[model samples]
Target: MKTKLFFFIFSLFFFLKSNAQCAMCRAVLENEEGQSAAKGINDGIIYLMSIPYILVFGLGFFVYWKYFRKKKVEA
Candidate 1:
């Protein structure tokens, strides 16, 4: 249990910080005269990237509620 917990915690840190853009995207965005476009692209990338994580979290919560969290019977 300790090993699994430690591994999860250790792995979590690696994923916490990420540079999501590819080299071409970064280069093009950086060269743009207007900073708003660059900022918008970054925002869009982050928004699109978060959907998978959100979906997985929702699925995990659903599974826990359905199977692990049992309801009490009323007499």
Candidate 2:
């Protein structure tokens, strides 16, 4: 389990680069000189994309911790 978790986290850091722009956005940004806007748009897209996964992971962890934690049994 620890190895699986370690590999999962390690694999996350090596994601392939992706172009997240829509067709129209790409067309417009392609004409710009520096291409910084295109990079910014792609970055913003990646940021927005990761948010829901992070939130869901946090919520799931909270639920697991709350419900599955060992409880004390008083004599």
Candidate 3:
């Protein structure tokens, strides 16, 4: 069933791609619309992608400073 659905969509994509005439038809068929909300959504995607790396590195620094440093005495 899953394979059938995948093949169906794959064939549809190739059929449409092969038949695309120009930018307008491609955009229409692909359902891409020019919208301000799309820019906001794109920004949201970038923020989500960056946040995990920032968090992991930030926590790594915090742990290293808080727990890994040796105590020193005046000599």
Measured by lDDT, the strongest candidate is: 2
lDDT of 3: 0.60
Q: By lDDT, is 2 or 3 better?
A: 2
lDDT of candidate 1 over 1-75, digit per residue (tens): 999889977966765555667789999988889778877777778779878987998998898787654553321
Q: Give lDDT tens digits, candidate 2, residues 1-75.
A: 999999977767754366678999999999999999899999999889889988998999998777666442321
Q: What total of clashing residue pairs does each candidate reach?
A: 0, 0, 0
Q: Which 10 successive residues of model 2 have the least lDDT summed? A: 66-75
lDDT of 2 at 9: 77
- Give Cα distance to truth, residue 10, candidate 3, Å: 39
Lowest-sum lDDT 10-residue window in model 1: 66-75
Ten-residue region with minimum lDDT total, candidate 3: 16-25
Name the top TM-score candidate. 2
What are the per-residue Cα lDDT tens digits for candidate 3 across 1-75? Answer: 999889967975664434323455445545656655444555555556657867987998898776656433322
User: Candidate 3: lDDT of 38?
Assistant: 46
Which residue pairs overlap in candidate 3's backbone? none
Model 3, position 71: C-alpha lDDT score: 35
The predicted structure with the larger lDDT, 1 or 3, is 1
